[model samples]
Structures are given as structure tokens and as C-alpha cells.
Target: MKTHIVFGESGGSSLRLALKDHQTNENIVVVVDDLMWGPIGNILLETVQEERIKWWEQVLNEEDKSDSIAYLRNTYKRLSDWTIALTGNESFLFWVGDSPTEYTGLMFLLANIPKSIPVSIIMVFPAYYKRYGRFKPLSAGEIIPEKSSILLKMQNPFLHGLEKDT
Candidate 1:
């Protein structure tokens, strides 16, 4: 199975949703850090429950069993194999009140990724304005550049989802 690691500020969730099904049965590991002084989302953990109420409502409405929850847990467990076993270390990570440059955990985790499997990295930021800004997606052959490669940037669907609010 190929491995894809996307890390950046402002568009982590958008990255996940875009890459999740890139390859069938591919394992996806998404880690979000606090974006206030650091990376992306700035909501407080204490208030995240209330803030995420709408998200939870959608989740509950979309998924109908504990197994759905279990699937995520199992997928995450597999991520450790690459980080711990391969890298031989771990650290306490705090996303809340941190800056994107401060964590740098993704760099460590990514260093351990086996080269045998295909891999790619994406860095996103808000371009233009919040309402319409997007992290342009890289086209096939562009993500992993080689001879005769053509790189193209595509629109992010998560940003498209935000169109509803606009």
C-alpha cells in the first residue's frame, strides 16, 4: 500500500478529505495541531465539544455504528508502526495553543516512512482570501516528479464544501 503524508497550515482537513480515497484501502493518518500560534484550527479543547456539535451531528447522521468509530481507531494504530517501531521514539504532542512551526512532529513521523511504498507531501495555505482561498491540488505525475512530468494544481473539494456557508 502506498503512503501519503500531507502537512501544512490552514488546510489539513481539506487535505485529508481529498486524499482519503486516492488509493483503495490506503491508510490515512491525519494529525492536526493548534493553529493559533502554530498551524490551523484555533478552537479550544474545552469548547471544542460545543463548537463541534454540528460536526458530531453530521457524523452521527452519517454513521450508524460503533464499528465506524472502531475503524478510525484501528487505522490510527497502524500509524504508530511507522513512527515508533521505525523511528524508535515518541513525544508528548500538544496541538492547543501551539504554532505550526513549533510542532514539527510531522517531519519526524514522515522521516520514518518506508521509501518502498509510494509517498507524497502537500503543504497548504490560504491564498487570496479565506472564503475563496484554496490549496491547489497537484495533478498526477506532478506529485512525484520525474522525467517528462507535468504538474498541475487542482481545486480542493473541502473549500468547495465551505461554499455552502457563503
Candidate 2:
């Protein structure tokens, strides 16, 4: 059986929807992280430790500190485990938007995965118009629930390489 891993922010909702509605035979693993909006100077935990501490101090109260820290640690582990599981044999796809946050997430994944593991990126823009009509580019959440069928039907989908724009 072929396994296709899809990674994105917001818990890979869009990718999950696309796979569920279309590619039922393939095993799908979704790695969702909000790394794009956070302080990610480096993919290494050590490099981002200071930033993480600062963020925790600023955003979390004393009562919530322990719980929040634990949550972050757990999330980091999950992200690391899933990312490391992307071998060259399994297909990989990254769904990202044209935003700094999304781009940062994509960069992080690109840096972590081995060069031999070919990665395909689907870039979502904020403003796009269809041939039949004009519509604003939808966010991942909006697109998944509203237009997943369209995504499933897409042929020759425009995919970019990880090396091109990073």
C-alpha cells in the first residue's frame, strides 16, 4: 500500500479532506503545526529555547505556565516524529499559503527532511480568479469545507519544488 503524508498548519484539515474525499486507498498522515506564526529562528529546539521562554512568559499566566509548557513539548514531539517518518519511499506534500507564517513552516519542513525525499508544495494565494468567475483566494479552513470536491478533481495541479522559492 502507498502512503502519502500531508503536512500543514491547522491540523492538516484541508489535506485530510482532500484525501478522504478522493484518495481513500492511500494511507494519509497529517502533521499540523502553527509554526508559521511563531518564533522559529531555527528548527532546533535549542535555538528556539530563548524565544519559547519569552513567549511563555509573555503570553501565559503563572497558573497556566506548567500546562502550556507541557502542551508545547508534546506538540514538538509529535511534529518531530511525524516529520522524521517521511522517508523517500512515501509521497510527501505540503499545503501552504502565500503568507510569512506558511512560508516559514514550509522552510522548516524543507530543512528537516532529507534531500533525497522529494517534496511537492501546493501554494495557496490570497487573491485568485477562476476562468468562469472571480473569487477571493480562500483560507485553508474555508477551502476545505467549501471546495474540497474541486480540489479532488484538480488535474495537473500546480506543484512547486521546495528548492525553488525558499
lDDT against the true structure, per candidate, is 0.32, 0.53
Clashing residue pairs, candidate 1? 34-95, 35-40, 37-99, 38-98, 38-99, 38-100, 39-100
In candidate 2, list every pair of residues with a backbone clash: none
Number of clashes in every candidate structure?
7, 0
lDDT of 2 by residue, 120-157 (tens): 55444432234223554434444543364454333233
For all predicted structures, in order, the TM-scores are 0.30, 0.63
Supply the TM-score for candidate 2.
0.63
Cα lDDT tens digits, model 1, 68-100, are 434433433444444444332222111111224
Instruction: Compute the lDDT of residue 112 as modeled in candidate 1.
Output: 36
lDDT of 2 at 104: 67
After superposing candidate 1 on the true structure, give the runs of residues whose Cα lies further than 4 Å from its correct spot: 6-25, 32-78, 81-103, 126-166
lDDT at 156 for candidate 2? 32
